[model samples]
Target: MINKRLTFCHENWSLREPFRISRGVKTCADVIHVAINCDQVTGQGESVPYARYGETTESVLDQIEEVLPEVEGGTNPEELLELLPAGAARNAVDCALWDLMARWQGRSVPELFGLEVQRELETAITIGLDTPEKMAKKARMNRRAPLLKVKLDQENILDRVRAVRIQAPESRIILDPNESWNMDILRLVDEELAGLGIDLLEQPLPAGQDDGLREYRPKVPVCADESCHTSQDLPALTGKYQYINIKLDKTGGLTEAVRLRELALGQGFGLMVGCMVATSLSMAPAILLCSGADFIDLDGPWWMAKDREDGFNIQNGIIRNISGNLWGGTEKAEAAVS
Candidate 1:
């Protein structure tokens, strides 16, 4: 006789505060959290939409429901891989299996994936889109983080950087325009930012317009985010971007992310391991990519009003697992989630 199957569910989460960027976001987030329960173990994953990318949690949850029958009927994660293409659904299932397997077998998921545990990492604190003054204030507050990822738009770009630089004069800085930049603004600000001690500039040009970058000369190194999704995006970015920001959600999950890393590095591209707004579980898998990354910007959960009970602890720009469960902290997490 076959054993009883597990339970599955997905829900929405709201950010404690609106996370503003160059585009327009002024309120709570509609996040999707996927949970899988089996026996005494449970695994969870989170997914967020990039409206610019045309994704929504409702659509993602609907996609999961479409596959609910198969998931309930003992379809394994490996099977889910072939049945479903990479996206939020496959990512949730893949990570849920990683968690379940780790718990049921008393092994750590990273170990299963052949990744070593990192004791410490210097993450880039995100300076949300704001006035030059407010952005600088945020940057000043986290000056000790060693690195800062400044979010910007086409408007008042110089003013914002000037303010932030005054406060965190010595902090290594990088800029993420999120494809809000055009050739005019990009070329216009390159010299100012390069002079301001900005080490790298991220996604200065729009995704489809990256072809223009071929003839362009950057004042600083340009890392690809929106322009670099899967490994297939690598060839197109050649000679255009010096680095690629690898987010698990964008690549689908940890499995494909690893493959994308190898392909990008082999083709001579730098790497930045990033994340959507997610709890530690989702960020943990991306840490592997950080092993060789030039920059680490995994500050997704920091914006949460109340992180999951057993979530990661952020202190002075470093992340540490508190519960010590196979995936993260369980005692603290279980007590909170339970």
Candidate 2:
């Protein structure tokens, strides 16, 4: 076994403004950054401990520590999947290993997977949940963005969506209720949302309770977020969702995320790559999964008050560039913790 070193720490990146979703609001992004060193080469990754998944920083830290010995003994991404479940802990380590391998091979992660990295890709700009007037204002501010992801809940569903639709009539819109709506609400709003030109509806119903979607057809395409994680969950999501939102954190990292994407597409599911509110270190690895995705919602770093040097360049909802020194590149990884 190759001698290696593993280290991790918790980081809190303050958001420029509070990001509100159906569940709650977040003013800071709490994440865990992991690094693995071998033969004087370092690779790094980051993950957000999602409260919606019952993950806390402490819990994630403990999970990583428990696997420290095996990781330092030179475990690969495939082996790390068996060591940790699909969540934030495995995500960090898995991504770090991928970055390490890519560096060792003198290629970018996308190249390692036989994929070409786009110089610029259009991404969705998120407008967090708020009052109709406030939401409209936010939409107006980002009207130039190619795509706008509007956060909504059960309350004022029509009002909120209508407000955003009126502000940015030309921008492609995605309504994400974040598992806050019931079948009745979805049925009631489906036609109206379709008429309003809402492009996609994400996870209207909660996980384990969305079996009702099997019989209900909607005017708008539905994407599964909370309801789907790895490829194992794809079987259950087959008839219910038209698209699956693949987030590395939810899939345990790019390793499973790639498998999930391939399997989901084979099963006739469209793709949407997403991310929790996090730093560029987290979003950098996700870029590999965005090649043929139908919807890209990787604006996590756009919400940060400040980002790391040599991070992704996002302007007007388009990711223009990803520096080589970032997470999954051929260049050496820098210290990612703040």
Candidate 3:
């Protein structure tokens, strides 16, 4: 037991603009930020409660508050896996623990895991769900981005994707319906998706409705977002999804995310590292898992009105690593603590 203290608070970050998906719209990102201080070093983590996963901001805060005693008493991150179920609450506490451990060991999580941190991670800039014309204008503005994730719904799916494809002709597109599409819509747009140069289609149909994908093959690779969580989901996702979007919030933090990635790869599923709208504190841990991922959507901070100081830099479409004790990197952590 290293001398430790646990503290948490809820933060609400107003987005520069409202971000919309099929389920709802968010004008701000509400997250729980947890900081663990072991000795003199303080490490931070953040988790956004997703309504899709049955979590609200208040519920997440309450969940963390419930475990304060155990966390302060010296519960390690590995032990945390047994404490909470996989969701936003566990994600906040688990990552905080990882951050604390990294600071204590004087190593970044990636270095601790013997993984090379990729200097530049190419991330897909998201164009949230909106009218085709508005979405197209947004796409044109980000034309320099190499990849564009176009959020869609049941209505005007082809028009929106086509509009973005036309505006950003060079960008590889990922169409994320966010479980708003049906088999008919998928069938209707099957051929056009490949023509529109959509490299990946994410969570087209609602969960449990995905069994249709077992036999219904399409030209574009379909990635699972809503359908997959941890390694336990691999069996159900097998033969249905070609890719799995891994988010720390969904996997209960980097611990399970790393495990899920290894298991997913062994099962022959392509990997994608993603994030909800969050700050760099949340994105930092996910960056460690970005190695060899087929797609990276950790651009949550890009949509924010402001970001933490020393946050990751986005030059063109490439997200460069940050140099600070934001979450990882021992030298930076030491500098921050000292």
Q: Is candidate 1 or candidate 3 better by TM-score?
A: 3
Per-residue lDDT tens digits for candidate 3, residues 244-328, read 9999999998889999988998889998989999888889888767777989998988878998877778755789755545777
lDDT by residue (1-338, candidate 2, tens digit) is: 26689999999999999999988999999999999988877889999998889999999999999999999987888899899999999999999998888777766777667665566788999999999999999999999998999999999999999999899989999999999999999999999999999999999999999999999888999999999899999889988899999999999998999899888888899999999999889998887788779899999999999987777788889996675687776443221210
Candidate 2 residues lying further than 4 Å off, grouped into runs, are 331-338
- Specify the highest-lDDT model's number: 2
TM-score of every prediction relative to native: 0.89, 0.96, 0.96
177 Cα displacement, candidate 1 (Å): 1.1
Give every collision pair in model 1: 132-160, 323-329, 324-329
Tens-digit per-residue lDDT, 1-338, candidate 1: 02324344554456666778777774554556666666656766666655666666666777777777776666766677666666666677666666666666656655566655575687888888988878877887898878888988888988988898888887888888888888888888888888988888988878998787888778799999988777878888998998999987787767678889989888888889888776676676677677788898887777776666666777667877634363532343233322
Clash count per candidate? 3, 0, 0
Ranking by TM-score: 2, 3, 1
RMSD (Å) of each candidate, 1 decimal: 3.9, 3.3, 2.5
RMSD to the native, candidate 3?
2.5
Error of 3 at 29 (Å): 0.7
Cα shift from native, residue 52, model 3 (Å) = 1.1
TM-score of model number 1: 0.89
TM-score of 2: 0.96
